[model samples]
Target chain A: MQQCYGSIIRRQRHFIRCLGGDRCNNSSSDTLLLLNDNTRMQSVMSRSNPAIEADALSILRSISPTLDSTKHKGQAGKIAVVGGCREYTGAPYFSAISALKIGADLSHVICTKDAAPVIKSYSPELIVHPLLEESYSVRDEDRQSVATVVLAEVDKWMERFDCLVIGPGLGRDPFLLDCVSDIMKHARRSNVPMVIDGDGLFLVTNRLDLVSGYPLAVLTPNVNEYKRLVQKVLNCEVNDQDGPEQLLSLASSIGGVTILRKGQSDNISDGKEVRSVSIFGSPRRCGGQGDILSGSVAVFLAWARKLVDKEGHTLNPTMLGCIAGSALMRKAASLAFEDKKRSTLTTDIIECLGRSLEDICPVG
Target chain B: MQQCYGSIIRRQRHFIRCLGGDRCNNSSSDTLLLLNDNTRMQSVMSRSNPAIEADALSILRSISPTLDSTKHKGQAGKIAVVGGCREYTGAPYFSAISALKIGADLSHVICTKDAAPVIKSYSPELIVHPLLEESYSVRDEDRQSVATVVLAEVDKWMERFDCLVIGPGLGRDPFLLDCVSDIMKHARRSNVPMVIDGDGLFLVTNRLDLVSGYPLAVLTPNVNEYKRLVQKVLNCEVNDQDGPEQLLSLASSIGGVTILRKGQSDNISDGKEVRSVSIFGSPRRCGGQGDILSGSVAVFLAWARKLVDKEGHTLNPTMLGCIAGSALMRKAASLAFEDKKRSTLTTDIIECLGRSLEDICPVG
Candidate 1:
């Protein structure tokens, strides 16, 4: 725990350096005092190896853009989710609309033709593209051409997107996976940030090279996905004893790609530092909460990158994005739970996104 | 701004002349006094080119018919919305249902065959007619016959409607627009008031002759639509320095048709006078709010027209309708926002319409 606190201080110093000494003067001391108090509280409350908790709310406030009348549509962020097939329309809809509810200027979903109309009907705010093709839809002879067409369609709008969220409702189809792989490569080439979740983790686990060594790529893996990743990369069983150390190793093995390992406490690691957002979340284990997190992460990642690019900030935007996204999703879930209790669904959590964001960083 | 206000008063007098003067004597002084107070407030606030704010709440109260046991089922209003296509079912549904919610006795939706069932499924309150046919459904050889058949279908029900809302989810289809143009002509012949919105605005902007010089026609244009209208009619860019004058000119250019320019503050004009409704409204810019406004406007326009016809009132029914509609929509939006906060969707705002109306003008 002492070593964990030391590492956090070191990371805090780096963040302070990025923000410049003059700008960090006030907040740095306050952050240190908060950390000291948290450490003291942890010593009294717990008798186990606790993961280093992150100041996710502060990170969220740091990255969130101020609402200005001068800023037009698509100025805050333009996020696109590369998912949604015949069987899984709600996942992409949840992710894309969650981005909009979280204050992104525009949210788009690139989905299979069959899913487009259904998703489009869900909300007029989303720009749904009926571009992806599944294996059953394409003949063996036409697979290559269809894949090429899908890539081309997505490529046309690639430059406009600040971030791409992959695999919320993305089903496991070989042809579709091939097309998404090509799309991922193109996004990587253009240096667009990505948040990978659900079946995207499946694709990445099998073909690690798709995201390996990509600093801007963020992989959000739940328990099963994380277990598979650990087995594939570390060639070992899941170790609960040194979870933070393993998560650190897992991220480091992926060549510094950030990993937000979702669980009881969302443990995030960018290899250099491992931080956990153990904030109060709803007990309701809803299916679509991960989709909301992916969407939230994409928006925050884009904003963080914008902040870094515009202000020359030194903090790892990917890590900051994961922390902020996790914290927000948890906050929204808690709020929804407070209202609906056990009946809270993913849509309820999504509806609370804007209010959660406003509570953290007011538009005014 | 003073000159603009003076011109509005002059136009108000002209409208009184059209309504036969005697009924204008009571409300005209009250409105002018409100304008005077607004002018004083504007000077103190150091505002430039301030629009003369209308007392929209009062207009809404005066125009809204009182509930009575003696009144028949359709006595309040019977509104028909001429929209909804394959790609859009929600917009027309929102408009039609909003009319019903805002005290209209009967609400009907004239939509394409593909959209009828879906719009009907949204609510049993709406009378959905899958009468309109798009180009895809009609062959080139059968175009004339199909259009004639569609017109005949709508014409049978035209006289029963108090007012027709001319576009909510009306998609841009050439054949459909042609059929709609024919329907517009028929409605004009019957002297039924038309509240044009969405694709109707698109249709009217291109073929201004469809609604040209029709006093019963009301064009509700949002920011983008308003820009297009200003470009097409005025042949210049939108100048905020002279927004009211430009809006008045735009209305006059369309031959005295009422123009409800929707924005942060809804600006209304009938070529004769300009009145702005800067009442409190939600900051959430979700889609379908325009649909609500169109429906609300249609109902109000019908009631205002009935009031004029029955009571020999001097106020311009169209102007009164726009002001009341704008005020009601804003109030509902504000109320929805207050409760739902950032989670406020168009549906949430629609739910508040009745409560908002009751709050403003309660039924004894």
Candidate 2:
């Protein structure tokens, strides 16, 4: 099954190479038309099935930066997870660690004071900051000052991070969410890409303005989260009969921000086109799996953006990131399940991440 | 001797597989009978000498969970060493790092403030908490509040740890011991298993009530510490003539808590059955071997407890933990001795833990 996927990915890579070569010689208008034509061809080929599955493996290969010895530590990528409170530590740890395991150079976690020691204990690889404040910990009189302090603390490291994973285990404490919303504004202002998941989805779903019109923002929502988002944005129930079209509309309604609707087949759309990643995955619906997906997307998104900015490719970086992250997560989960079966957990999938990436795109 | 031990472990694994398959159709009573019968047969076979040695290698294999990709970080084990004061740091580092080398996903050290930086400098892999306080640091008036604060700090993370190894380089400070006593009492209240060694043995020997009726407590005592425990508990001198019986009485007097007596044969008992791990060990009477033993016992104990809890096994997890810990420590020590000979330090023995475990239970 994997070999067949690999062959299809190889063909897609060949097509992309041809497109890149043609763009070098052709006019910008002609190149743009060629890109559209390529997308149309892929859509037609995939029309045999209702869901338009993405060439996720090819997108992953094309965007993954070739590891160079000359490159410095942070050159690979620096990802920060802005989640972790007294109630939730494992989610942030899973996300941050997943980023590092997926080849990010540095992974940081910005969490509340109560969660720092425990999350720090999870892995020494992560740089954990006990900066954020929850409602219970912050008094109403001191909320304004504390919010400023929290934003200032994150602002110092904002420019350095290639991307930020906004929520993994982020709890929905009103005061904490307010501070995170501020952080999101600063990140968006800095033009840094953000992957929102877990409670971040909750935050953005209720207050769409936090991510609306931010092309760099990626919202990854599971079934219930997507339902809530659809209700909030589209003002209607989720239409399973036309999930892709509705997802595309949902993205478009949110001002063209990318939305990756997580399910048996993860559907990603950027209001331009819909893509699905239906590769093999484990049946275990573990809690922290989404955190891993968010972290992976953050790293891949950063790499994809870097590729487009440097190589001048017209690919949708957010869409590419979602496709690659979903594919890799599913592949890793499948490998973990093969070994652990009924006992499969989030950490098992995490351990297989490096091997899975290597299987798809060897470091050599 | 190592080959002989490996064969015994292999045979035991085969037996366990057959028994596990039988468990699907067989009644619980039949399974219990088979378990007891197996234990009895092994005991009878090892009764050729004065000391009844356990099939340590087999016990280690049975308790050691297979390394599956589906397991998360802490699922293998999350151990904490509550030791390392200003005066002594290497012992706690040895204990905590030994746990990681033996396959625990995370290892933490709760030490005195002054010891934290030194321990942290030793290895970035360990999560070191500088929370404990000694007499000189705390004023007479602030002692109570300081103690309370220290206890609270540890209490917050008490539930997350799989097992706690109390006192590897824990100094003999009155104030620190008092704080640790409170921590131990809290751990007992929370039902978190503790392995007491080094200065922890001193604290427990003087104040037996802290772990009096706690079956989850495992006391790992060296020669002098064992002498003190025997004197404190049985109120008598050491008796080599009836070593196993004396060990049994000592453990029984402690209300069925497991005791791993460090010596040539490493006798273990829980007042129920006396099992000695007389596997081939190095002649090196090293200082930090007990710390390694404490750490290894904590991991194995956690694994054994998890297995029993999930699989409904009939064996005593604590006893199995002691046996497995003893066998692996011995095997690692022997391997380290073969390589370094006279220069085999505690670190050398620690470096051998992974290979030693792999030899007994291959990951493949």
**Best lDDT among the predictions, by candidate number:** 1
User: Model 2: number of clashes?
Assistant: 0
DockQ of each: 0.16, 0.03
The 10-residue segment of model 1 chain B with minimum total lDDT is B40-49
Q: Write the per-residue lDDT of candidate 2 for residues B70-134, one digit (tens) a residue.
A: 34446677899999998999999999888776767677899998888677667545667779999
lDDT for each residue of candidate 1 in A184-293, tens digit (9 for 90 to 100):
99999999999999999999999999999999999999999999999999999889767777888899999999999998889898877777787788999989999999
Residue-wise lDDT of candidate 2 within A37-124, one digit each (tens)?
Answer: 5553444244322344567888888899998789988988999999987656778988999999999999999999977877888778
Candidate 1 chain A lDDT trough over 10 residues, lowest sum: A40-49
Candidate 1 lands at a TM-score of 0.81
lDDT of the candidates, in the order given: 0.84, 0.81
